[model samples]
Target: MNATQFKQALTHVNLLDIRTPREWDDFNLGGFHVSLDTLLERIDEISKEKNWVIICYNGTQSLIAMRLLKAKGFTHIDHLEGGLEAYLSL
Candidate 1:
C-alpha cells in the first residue's frame, strides 16, 4: 500500500517494521519491530491471523518481508510503497 492507503488503514492493520535496530531507535512510526536481517530467524513469532503491514526505511526491504510472510502462509499482508520516508514526506 502507499502511504495514503496505509494511513487510511492504520487503525485496522498490524504494523511490522523491518528496519535495522539503529534505524528503529533513531526514529519509528511505532509498531512491532523485527529487523530485516533477523526476520527469518524470528518469523515464527509473527502471527498469521492479523492483517500485517510491513514497513522499512524504503519500500525495498518491506517488499522482501511481504514475500517472506506470504511464503509462510500469511494471507493478509501489505507494505508501504515508499516506506516511512514517503509517509513522512506526505
Candidate 2:
C-alpha cells in the first residue's frame, strides 16, 4: 500500500523493518528490525497469525521480502509502498 494507506493501517498491522542494522540505527520507525539478509533464518521470530507489513529503505526490499514470505505460506503479508522514505515524507 501507499504511505498514507500504510499509516492508516499501522494500528492494525505488525510492522517488520527489514533494513540493515546501520540503517535501522540511523532511523527507526518503531518496528522490529530483522534485516533482509537474516529474515528467512529468523522468520519464526514473527507471528504468523498477525497481519504483517514489511518495510525497507525504499520499499524494494520489502516487496522482495513479502514475496518470500508468501512463498513460505504466509498469506497476510504486505509491503509499505515507498517504504520509510515515503512515510517520512508525509
Candidate 3:
C-alpha cells in the first residue's frame, strides 16, 4: 500500500517495521519493530489474528518480509509501496 492508504488503515492494521534498530530509533511510525534478519526466528511473537502492514527503508525488505509471513500462513498482509522514504516524501 501507499503511504496514504497506510495512514487510512492505521487503526485497522498492525504495523511491522523491518528496518534496522538504528533506523527505527532514528524515526518510526510506531507499531511492532522487528528487524528483517531476525523475522523468522521471532515469528512466534507476532499474532496471526490482526491485519499486518510491513515497512522497510525502500520497500525491498518489507516485500521480502511480507512474502515470508504469507508463506508462514499469514493471510492479511500488506507493505508500503515505496517504503519509509516514499512515505516521508509525502
Best by lDDT: 3
Record all residue pairs in model 2 with backbone atoms less than 3 Å apart, i.e. clashing.
none
Model 1, span 1-90: residue lDDT tens: 999998888888889999999999999878799999899999888899888999997799999999988988999899999999988888
Cα lDDT computed for each candidate against the true fold: 0.91, 0.91, 0.92
Reference-based TM-score of each model: 0.95, 0.94, 0.94
Candidate 2 local lDDT, residue 26: 92
Q: What is the TM-score (0 to 1) of candidate 2?
A: 0.94
- How should the candidates be ordered by lDDT, best one leading? 3, 1, 2
Task: Using TM-score, give the best candidate's number.
Answer: 1
Q: Which one wins by TM-score: 1 or 2?
A: 1
lDDT of 2 at 82: 97
Q: Cα RMSDs of all predictions?
A: 0.8, 0.9, 0.9
Ten-residue region with minimum lDDT total, candidate 2: 24-33
lDDT, model 3, position 34:
94
Give the alpha carbon lDDT tens digit for every residue of 7-87 in model 2: 899888888999999998998878678999998999899878889999998999999999999998899889998989999
Q: What digit string (tens of lDDT, one per residue) describes model 3 on residues 5-63? A: 87677788889999999999999999999999999999999999878999999999999
